[model samples]
Structure formats: structure tokens, C-alpha cells
Target: MSEQSVTYMDLRFHTPAEQKRKRRPKHTRDTEFSEQEVTYSHLKFHIPSEQQKQQTSTSAESTDYPTPTSSWLVTVILGLLCMALLVTAGVLGAKFLQLSHRVRRQNEELIEKQAILGNFTQLQETLKNCTNQRDDLQAQKANFSKVVSRKGEKCSLCSEGWIEHGGKCYHFSEERRTWKKSQEYCSSHNSRLLVIKNKEELDFINRLVCFHWIGLSRGGAATAMKWEDGTAHSTDLFQVKKETPGESCVALNAEGGAIRKCAEEFRYICEKKPS
Candidate 1:
């Protein structure tokens, strides 16, 4: 062999110890690179811890405060409610005033009606009084007419069954009676026994054809003659004849007057003033 050929063969073929050392270095480098890749994957796919979730929820709650628009909407609703309450109050007040006015007017009307009723009652009383007065006047007028018709004069001065003479009324009785009885009869008729005031009256009585008892009387023979009225007989008048004892009364006829016992019965004449 040549020396150059021997050196070329030694370079191409390595020893066992040199190849083992180069392979050990390459294996260690591959193992280190695989461990680094596993670490990076774990970091990329990780879940959040309990403390991180709490922090996120707190930040979200902080953003939940009321805004300005919502506050304005609430104010508008409160204003609408106040306006409705004011309108209702105004309507109630007006209705109350109207009712009060109506009640006052009714009271006034009632008072007026009461006044009218009182006035009507007064008028009725006045009418009743006038009616009573008219009735009384009518009765008086009727009485006057009857009196005037009987006498045929403007006014009647005497009653019925009486003769008027010298402003006096006279009545003559046909029946006979005692002197006392005749006087009682005259008294019952509102008159007295015929009395002669003068000779003219005696003459006028004598014209009648009646025997009648007179009012002249005496208690005894010596006593003076007197009339029923207690007046003494005048001497100027016609004298009485035929005197009797004890109590005696005078009687007259057409002829003359005579004294007789009081128990003697005769027709009588009565006299009274005109009505």
C-alpha cells in the first residue's frame, strides 16, 4: 500500500467511541425543546380564578345608577296627579255654593207665604164684623117701619090699643073691677089710673059715656084727697061728691065725680105718656 491511500481510508471510517458522543448531544437537545412546547400550551388554555370573576362582577354593578331621562319622566307623572286633584276641588266648591243659594231662596219664599196668610186672616175678621153690624141696622129699620105703618105718619109716637091726646096715651076698660084691682091692671100695662089735672081735663073726661074709677083717694073722712102719685087734689079741679067712711076711692061718670068705698067695682080708665 501507498501512504495517501491509507490516510484516505482512515478518514472515511470513524471509530465507535466518536459516533457515540455526537448522538448523546443530539438527544438531550430534543428533550429540552419538547418540555418548552408543553409549558406554552398550558398558559394559552387556562380558566379564570375565583378572585378575578368577583372583580369583573363588581365593575358591572357600578354602572347601574339612574339616568337624567328617567328622573324627568317621574317628575311629569307627579305634576299630572296634582293638576287632577285641583280640578276636582274646584268643582265640589261650585256645587256647594249653588245648593246654599237655592236653600236661601226657598226660605225667603216661605216667609212671604206666611205673611200673605196672616193678611188674609185679618181681612176675614173685618168682613165678619161688618156683616154683624149690617144685620143689627136692618133689624132696627124693620121695627121703625112697622111703627110708622100702623100710625100712617112719618114716625109713630104711641103703641097699639092706645088713644093719643095731649101728648099722652089713654086706655078704657069695659070690664068692672075693684079700685085696687083696677090700679094693679093699670100698673101691669105700664100706666096709671086716670088723673084729672084741671077742669078742662075733667070736662074732656066727662064727654065719655063711661063710669070709671079715678086715681083720687082718701084714708079717712077728715083726711085730704090725694092722687095715686101722692099729690094733694087741687081745689080748682071739679069737686068730688058722695063721700064714704073708712078708706074710699073717687069714681067718675059723664054726669060728675063721686067718692065711694075702695071695695066697690067699676070700669076704669088708664093714662100714660106717649112712647
Candidate 2:
């Protein structure tokens, strides 16, 4: 190998004359230099110092960091957004409570109305029952009045064919019949042979007809007089007249009641109550 020549690089710019002679194109003519450049003739090697590398790394890290003012603005914007979300939630919750209250009130009103309607229905039923009772009472009153009026008319007067006295009627017959036959005929006409309770009735009959069969009679025993209804007769009404010792039948005349034969046929008088 030949002997190597060692050269030192000058840490200085080229001279203007040497630069003009080379006439190299300048790519950074207007740019300012951050560090000084050194040239070595016939060499193409580059190496950075430890101090320079450290400075470049520090600049890059500084560019990534944010400023104090920008960080404060971002924090404030986030806080505002959180506040808006809270307000919206509160409004929605209040609206839900209001809806629930309204629904409960409506339900209460509906229940009250239904109770009132039920009471009204009961009242209507009671009124109908009372009306029915009133009508029934009115009908009973009308029927009672009709019965009273009919009874009064009957007691007031006797029929045209009857003789009236003391709220009673009497029929005098001229046809002759035995006492038993005459009683049978009177019963068929819903009447009875004349019964003289007092002197007034006895005298009234005497005036109408003479020697008619009477209801007075002597019992089967001799001289024991009794009325046709089986009661003993008192001598106060009229003195008894016996044609014989055992005359069981009796007759009435203008004077007094007399005992007569049962087989004898004579006029008769029948007595009856008004219809």
C-alpha cells in the first residue's frame, strides 16, 4: 500500500472567489443558518455530536405539549356539556311525576261517580214499592164503601109486596093451610112464621088478619107454653087460651094469643128481615 496523506477540515466558509469559480447552484440562499458548517475536500461522511442530538429531541417533545390557555378552555366546555345533560334529565323526571298525578286524580273522580249512580238506582226502586202500596190501600177503601152503601139501602125500605115495621117485613096469606104446612112454605121463601115478641107486633098483626097461626105453642107437657124456638114463654105478653087440656098449637086474634088445634087450617103471617 502507498503511504496515506491525512488532511484536516477547516471549520470556515469558502472564500467568495473560490465559490465564484466553482459556481455551484445555491438551494438555501435566503435561509439563515442555525449551526455553522465545516467542509472537507474529497470526503463524504457525516456525524452529529451528542449535544446536537439532545437539542433536536428536546424541540420535538416541546412541540407536542399544549398551552395553559387552550387546556383551560377545553375543560370549561366539557363542564358545560355535563350541566346541560343534568338539566334535561331533571325536566324529564318532573314531567313523568306530573302525568302520574293526573292519572290518579281521574281514577278517583270515576269511582265517586259510580257510587252516586248506585245510590240513585236504590232510591228509584224504593219509590216504585211505595207507589204500589198506596194503590192497594185505595182499592180496599173503595170496596168497603160499596159494601156499606148496599147494606144501608136494604135496611131503609121493604119491597112493594111486603108490609114494613120496626126494620122488618111481614107477608099475610089468605090461603088456608095447617100450621106445619104454613111454616114449611114460609121457610121455602126464606121467611119464618110470625113471631110476636111484644104487644106492639102482636097488635099490629091482629089488625092485618084475624085468627092467624102464631109461633107460640104449649109444649108436649100439659099447660107448659113455649115459643116455636124452644124457649119458655112469659105470661106478660099475652094470657094463654087453651081450648082443651092439651092444645099444643096456638092462634092469635085481636084480643090475645089462644091455644088451638094443630090440624085446623087458617090464615098465616110470615115475618122476614130486609134483604
Candidate 3:
């Protein structure tokens, strides 16, 4: 009601101040009394005891909700950091070991290569020495050839059993005999008529031969030259006439009197111990 209407009635004016103070305005008591309640102070906005209790209960429930940092967060984080560092350190240490091993292997390989190179050099030196010795040997061979050819150009003829000795003449009339009988005779005596070898032998024999028969001859044009012993001809121990590899008769050389023959009569030249 308007204060003017309440004074016109005069009853509210006579009411005690204490009693009036105790009474709240109608808008404060019943929510339906006003379309909207305006609150400007704590007393006006104060919530009911029941509603406050309900709010307290709801806040208590949310407080019990778990959060990430509530338990063991520091310890767990510290442990994880330590693990990361340990894993990183372990990886680094393994890599370092691998690298170190590789380096050592490389060093060993280099050392081995150097050793091989040293051995190769030593082998080269040895080979060089061998080559030098070989060259010297070849030179000596050439010199020996020259000396032999000059001494063997001439020979004497008409002697008994002449043997060609070292580029010279030596006669052994004891060894002389006819071609066929000479082979058998020499076999009995354990000594054979000398077989002429090269020009040296021919020259030497000529000096001693007096119609000595040789161990070589062809019995006919188609017959092969051979020794009287019935064995095949051999160039290893005896030599035939210069070009008479195919000659067929035995005779003495005109110059050296060296015994020679054709297939018809092959004087034998036997070989044995030096005695």
C-alpha cells in the first residue's frame, strides 16, 4: 500500500517500531508477490538454509573427483625423465662402441696391408737377384760355344780304333774289327769301338782310322741306318756322317779315317762304365 493511504487509516502509524521492523515487505516473503525481485545487498540475495545445504553437498562431491597431479605425479614424472635420459645414454654408448670397433678394425686392416706390401717388396728383390744370375749364366754359355767350334774344324785319318777325345784325337787299335764281328767282339770284351759324334770326333778319328768301319749304315736304299748290334740307330749317344743319317754302308772318313757305314755293315759302338 501507498504510505499516503496507510497514514489516512492511521493504524500503521500507531504500531510499535519493533513490530514493524520484524515484518518483511510482502515482496520479500512471497515470490509470487512480484514479477521480479531485485537484490542489491547480501540480505536480499541470501539463499535458504536448505538450498545452502544442498549446494554444500554438491561441492563436496566434486572435491572427491580425481585430478592428474593429486598422487605420485612428481615421482612418476621424475622417473620418466630419468628413463628417457638412461635410454638416450644407452643408445649413445652403443653407437660409440660400434664406432670404436670400426675404427680399430680399420687400423688393423691398414697394418695388415702394410705388412703385405713389405713382403711383396722382399719378393721383388729376390726375383731381381735371380734374373741377374740367369743373365750371367746365358753369357757363359755363349762363350763356351765359340771355343768348341774353332778347335773341331780339322782331323787326321787312317788309324785303328780312334776315339774322339775332347776336341782331339786318340786311337785305340785294340777296339778295331770288321762291322758284324766288331759288335760281337766288343760285347765279349766289354768295350765297343768308338762312335763318332760331331765334327770334333770326325776330325779326331780321321787321324787314327786306317779303314775303320762305323756303327751306322743302311743295308739298302729302303733300310734305316743302325748299329751292328741289331739295335735301332740312336742320336743320343752316337752321331752319323754329317748328312749321312740315311747312308747304307760302312767306311772310314777320308780326313779323320773316322769309321762310318751304310745299312749293309753297321760296326757296333758299345757303351759301358768308364773302365
Estimate the TM-score of every prediction: 0.43, 0.41, 0.31
Q: Evaluate all candidate structures by whole-model CA lDDT and list the values in order.
A: 0.73, 0.70, 0.52
Between candidates 1 and 2, the TM-score winner:
1
- Candidate 2 lDDT by residue in tens digits, 174-194: 688988888898889888888
Better of 1 and 3 by TM-score: 1
- The local lDDT score (0 to 100) that residue 155 gets in candidate 2 is 62
Model 1 residue 27 CA deviation in Å: 99
Q: Evaluate model 3: give its lDDT.
A: 0.52
Which pairs in model 2 have colliding backbones? none
Per-residue lDDT of model 3, residues 110-187, tens digit only: 999999999999989756754564465356435433543443454322123333346333333334455667656656
Candidate 2 error regions (>4 Å): 1-157
RMSD of 2: 30.1
lDDT of 1 by residue, 143-241 (tens): 535644766574556666565556677776768999999999999989999887877677656655245798889888789889988899886777678
Q: Which parts of model 1 have CA positions greater than 4 angstroms off?
A: 1-154
Off by over 4 Å in 3: 1-71, 148-275
The lowest-lDDT stretch of 10 consecutive residues in candidate 2 is 1-10
Weakest 10 consecutive residues, lDDT, candidate 1? 1-10
Q: Summing lDDT over every window of 10 consecutive residues in candidate 3, give the lowest-scoring window.
A: 1-10
